[model samples]
Target: MQQDIRDKFKNYKEENVELSKNHSIKFEALLQQELHQNKPKKNYIKWLSVAASVMLLVSIGIQFYPNKTSEPIITKNDNDTTTKQITLGNISPEFNTIETYYTNSINLEISQLDLSDENKELVDSYLLKIAELTKEYKNLTQELNTKGVNDATIDALIRNLQLRLQLLQRLKKQLNEFKNLNTKQNELQII
Candidate 1:
């Protein structure tokens, strides 16, 4: 029985089968038909996407475009031959009042300082500090013009003014103390 099973296994042979030429041609035709059927759908989707993108870009451009009628009129000063600049004072009545008040207060504090020969260096140092603060204030004003009124910038502008006034007041007080000290030293020397 074992010899019979071995003989049957040795006699078995695998068959090599392949698709006929006619079936191969039919398969290729079916594949081309499927691709042709889907081509229009793919092109339609591509054109639809491009059209949507163009509409989106046009809407964004429209939103960013400045309106000519609402634009501010900028008139050059004839006498100075310089362009007039805008500031927070021009933005609103409330801001104008606040700006005017701070400016006047800062000027008053500056004018009250005793800028004698002895105190010239001290005064100059304070002036330099004030000038730096003024530059920062100008930057804040430009920011306000570009970004419009916001709490952070408004507070910064006001704080800059306050700091300038405080610096001037402190300088004045120090100068007065220096004068008193000098007067006392002169009296002691004479005695």
Candidate 2:
């Protein structure tokens, strides 16, 4: 009975060894197939890198290429002289106001007469402009007040507007003085 048990154990060991060998062969074949499939992917990545490098080099070359020729458009016209050349003080209100004030004052003193139609017209024009500006400023202030303006900013804007209004009033007074001076001169001339 003991001899039969030893033979049975030996047969079991031989079968286990054969089964292990077959499993090892199958695993090695699976590994080989996986490696073969990955080999082409490595080559594809290498080719992709080369292609990208070539495209980058071509783009850089195009950017550095210089333009061979270019020209500006030109036209000639005989009537171009009709346009007036505007100097610095040509349309400056500050300068114009000062010039007009001085000229008008001199003319008034020389002429020595009551307000003429032209003089009244000039004064009225300036006053109307001032009144318009004043009304605009008032409306702006009212809107700002309704919108809850900052106190400090409101004060600053008000101060600036007052200064502008003062300047306008000063201009008006200067013009009136010119007219009065003309009237006085005319009275003196009569006397």
Candidate 3:
């Protein structure tokens, strides 16, 4: 059927066809109408883009502003003295960099966790320990502010952060092992 159609088309000859006298004029009018219609859409998109840019600038500005309540707070103690709660990051730029790196990594790991009923118990136990460490970290920061900076306190704070990260890593490793073991058991049952 396709071959017959192909042969018929091959045998066909071109024949001139006449267009209406007003065809070019109508086509030009249509093109003008389309161009005018398209222009308003482009302007709408331009305004939308401008709005997005303004919002982005405002958001970036807000990000740079210091957040007061969620973090270290200033408390006035004794006679006419304001003392801000001390933190590891506030201690030094180096400590701040280290602390930031560890915090970001820990948060990233937690965010990526694959939570399921199979790993709930394990995850909960590890999280409980992390919570305890977090409390201890807060205590040590308080101690640092109260008794002033000590080598032991600094070391303990650093260690606490290390332990939290390590616990998350261990939890991840155990979850992977559990999944692999379960997969193998299912494969065995299938056989």
Candidate 4:
């Protein structure tokens, strides 16, 4: 039985199996053709990637580039004093006085604010409101310039300044209250 199995194995090993002569050649040709076909596409992709990178760099540069021209400064020459022209506040000395008073008071209040880190956010919010009012005031000034000084415009301007000062005063009081509350809480915690 062993001899018979060995003979069968020998017969199987000796069987002639003829592979197609063109099989490997055809495969090689197909591979070469595919490589050639993809060459241009790879080049195209490479060029596109480079172009996209260049565009990205250019856009970023443009966004971050500093402006070249600066605003011109106008200086007054005291020695060459000509007759001073009357301007907005010059129209009414009382209006100038009111504006100066309110502005100085608001500035003093701002300077006195507790600018600690804890109060910073609150202060910033108050400043934002003041800035908005200031913008409105600027618009009113522009209107006054264009329409020439009217009582209503002057009143609005003064009112805007007053509102800014009042806002600052309120913010100061609120901050003080907050500080006092914090102090009391700290004391309680200690006790």
Candidates 1 and 2 compared: the better one by lDDT is: 1
Cα RMSDs, all models:
15.7, 24.9, 12.0, 17.3
Per-residue lDDT tens digits for candidate 3, residues 21-118, read 99999999999998877444457788999999999999999987764423454586979877877788877667777788888888988987888998
Highest-lDDT candidate = 3
Please tell me which predicted candidate would have the highest TM-score against the true structure. 3
Worst 10 residues of 1 by lDDT: 66-75
Off by more than 4 A, model 1: 1-86
lDDT of 4 by residue, 3-110 (tens): 677677765756688979999999999999988784444578889999999999999998777533322223346888643332345565566667668888999998
Better of 1 and 3 by TM-score: 3
* Tens digits of lDDT, candidate 2, 36-119: 774444578889999999999999998766423212122335677432322112223443444345434534543443346747
TM-score of each: 0.54, 0.28, 0.59, 0.54
Q: lDDT of all predictions, in order shown?
A: 0.82, 0.55, 0.86, 0.80
**Residue pairs in clash, model 4:** none
Where model 2 places Cα greater than 4 Å from the true spot, the runs are 1-118, 142-147, 151-153, 164-168, 187-191
Ranking by TM-score: 3, 4, 1, 2
